[model samples]
Target: MGNAGRNAVVLVVTKVADATADLVIEQLNARRIPIVRLDPGDFPTSVAVNAYLGNHGLSGSLRTPSRIADLRGIRSVYWRRPSPYSVADDMRPQDAHWCADQARYGLGGLLGALPDAHYVNHPWRNRDAEHKPAQLAVAARCGLDVPPTLVTNDAERARWFARECGPVVYKPVRNTDYHGDDSRALTVWVEEVAPSEIDTEVGRTAHLFQQRVDKVADIRLTAVGDQLFAVRIDGAPGLDWRRDYDALSYTLIETPPEVAKAVRAYLDAFGLVFGAFDFGLDRHGRWWMYECNPNGQWAWFPDPITERITAALADRLQSPGNAHAR
Candidate 1:
């Protein structure tokens, strides 16, 4: 590494409880790299940003509790899951909402404007890539095998689509906070939907329905820059492997050249440098694209795979290069 990389700071934007971030930070620390970790949610409280625009460009400093980082000298930004911006609870509800919005745009904008730092997956890009509709369309365009999918809020249309694509599964367009009557968290797992189960309640919001893949296994392929680590997940109890993670076993697997090519193309299309892709392996050994989580978790995997992923991330973060290809 040259002086620029050797001396540059890696800004980690994430929550304090992230174990994945901690792993990468350990690697950087061992290499004696400079790192500044902060959560935007702490803005106006524990975190602060001071930026200036001049002839050169935007320059500033971010001060967190443990460290201060020079924006101009930042080499890379690991945009992990950061907490939402918040304000003092004593403020009126309206005032608090407005304050939070300002904090989001103000401090959030500054982080996005860092002059030289490369973001693993820029927040804006992550937001855009999070849409399942766009992801399916792009996956098909990139030569990946995407299941027949439909996104609609019309009850009749949803019923018709289910009839046509019988044995379909209902999936949430996006996973958001949902609670039951008891105020307990709830999850809408992917489940086989019979056409008769469709009703007017579906009209309340949009839903995603896809022909369920007859798969023998699932794959969680985590890509960091050009490096892809694929693992075959076996023994999932149902349609969604996530429902029973404890029952799953993993085996390191090689990605088919065609699938690998399409994955890179898909990432390029989204301008994403990192993505955790989910795929279903059919009985015939074909991979069906499910979705890609731009900022997905990886530390939950077994140690060997997790260590490899951590090293790949550290390699990308330590080097200076534009992750945003578009």
Candidate 2:
């Protein structure tokens, strides 16, 4: 809901009452940015294909724009993590598909409709933005060393790659919709996959296989505009660092000039102004591109991370010259 006269920023997040996004919301408020949160689950089952916000202010919300005496005034938008919902919990697959699809594409369009409001990362662009294979290609084009990779559904081919490479890793082709208790599911870390385990029957579904690189460290590159910052995560054991966040140690590190240049190109390739990229630094310290998450979480990271992102976003959103055109 827009306050008729107040400059309100709307944030669409699930479980708005809890979660880390709430902390970001608090920070926004501390900066005196008026915010209104909407849970997608609470929205109408269907919506128009076009965006609906007006310069006059937001309407049809928990608060009334006219009564609140507010004008349409959201200066920027941060597409943080979106909340989750299940149509299977109640509706049929087809019905659920339509509902979720419309909400995602539609709600995103509405936010994009905001006059002159800057988006941290646009959704339409994010759709095809981060495929692992595509990222690898981009990394190579930018002169970054990309590890040998194989994506297949054939058991024989997968096994052959494993046997040829000895120690290899297997993971999903894209991000899965499972989290919370399933944090383990987010791992794309390297592990030895024996060739014997390959079911000549793997033709059932497509799986990703990659040659494992012995890593001496990991790096998380957070890019905001032209500003590139990387943190070297040292001494993290196990294939997935996310599995043991508590034990991981971090040190601010400078990326190679070429690597930094490549990171910017990778984000620009996706039309993204922000991203959190994961890389496996080989035993020789050569960086191997894993994936770039357009909406990856970083609030839990170090203070410099928070300061860089928050300041960059604020500058873009509050710029007097970036106003939306009617």
Candidate 3:
């Protein structure tokens, strides 16, 4: 290995108590890789960064309580789930906003500009793949089977689609947490809807209505680099498999070659090295793509799947050139 490769470090961006990050970091540690794990939520306070333009390119140091990471020496960055930056409560609202912007564009921007550093999946690319409509379109374009989807804000159109499509499902454009009357947080679950349920209120905002696929099982495919780990999830009949994790049973299975090819193609289209794809496996043995989460959760999965994913990620971080080769 060259000097740069010898001195390279792996930067992990994630919040505390993230089991997924913990596993990956554990693997990296076993491989004797230098790592700097920092949560940006403590930025401008506990976490400090100083970057400057130099002859080599963007160079900086990220300082936390225990250690400091040399920005220039970062070969691969695992952009896992990091909490949002928090500002001082005593600061004015406007001042806090300004400070947050600086932290984002300044420190965040410098990290984004690192030379030859591979981000597992770039943050901007992650944001782009998060769009359900865009993901459907891309999956379809990649020759993956996708269910008919309609995004509209017109009640008449929604009703027409619902009537034409035998069984349609209503899903939020983006899942969000809402407080109930009792101040308890609740998440909106995907539910099958009828034509009669279409109301004028749907016209108030854009909504997603898709023809529900007659699926016997759900598939969760976690892609790390070019490798895809598929798990067949069998559970109670429901519009959303995520409604109850406890009710689900998982089995590791090989992904069909054609579908796997489409998955790799979809990742290329999104410029992502990693993605978590959900699919509906129909009773007729057809697989239909739903969406891909660029920064999705994978640790809770069972058996060899989680272990395989953790190793794949650690390998990618340990050898980033393989990611580009894929």
User: Which stretches in model 3 have alpha-carbon errors above 4 Å?
Assistant: 1-3
Count the clashes in each prediction: 0, 10, 0
| C-alpha RMSD values across all candidates | 1.9, 5.2, 1.6
Q: For residues 204-277, could you state the per-residue lDDT of candidate 1 as single tens digits?
A: 98899999999999999998878899999999999999898899999989999999999999999998999999
What RMSD value applies to candidate 1?
1.9
**What's the true lDDT of residue 118 in model 2?**
57
Model 3 lDDT tens row, 1-326: 22157878888988997888999999999999989898888887898888878675676688988878777688888898888878899999999999889888877777677777888878778888899999999999998999999999999999999999859999898877799999999988888899999999997888999999999999999998778899999985687878788999999999999998999999999999999998999999999988888999999898577999999999998988755643
Extract clashing residue pairs from model 2.
3-70, 4-69, 4-70, 4-71, 5-69, 5-70, 6-70, 115-324, 116-323, 116-324
Q: Candidate 3: lDDT of 112?
A: 73
Global lDDT of each candidate = 0.90, 0.66, 0.87
lDDT of model 2 at residue 43?
47
**Clashing pairs in model 1?**
none
> Model 2 Cα displacement at 29 (Å)?
1.9
Ranking by lDDT: 1, 3, 2
lDDT, candidate 2, at 216: 89
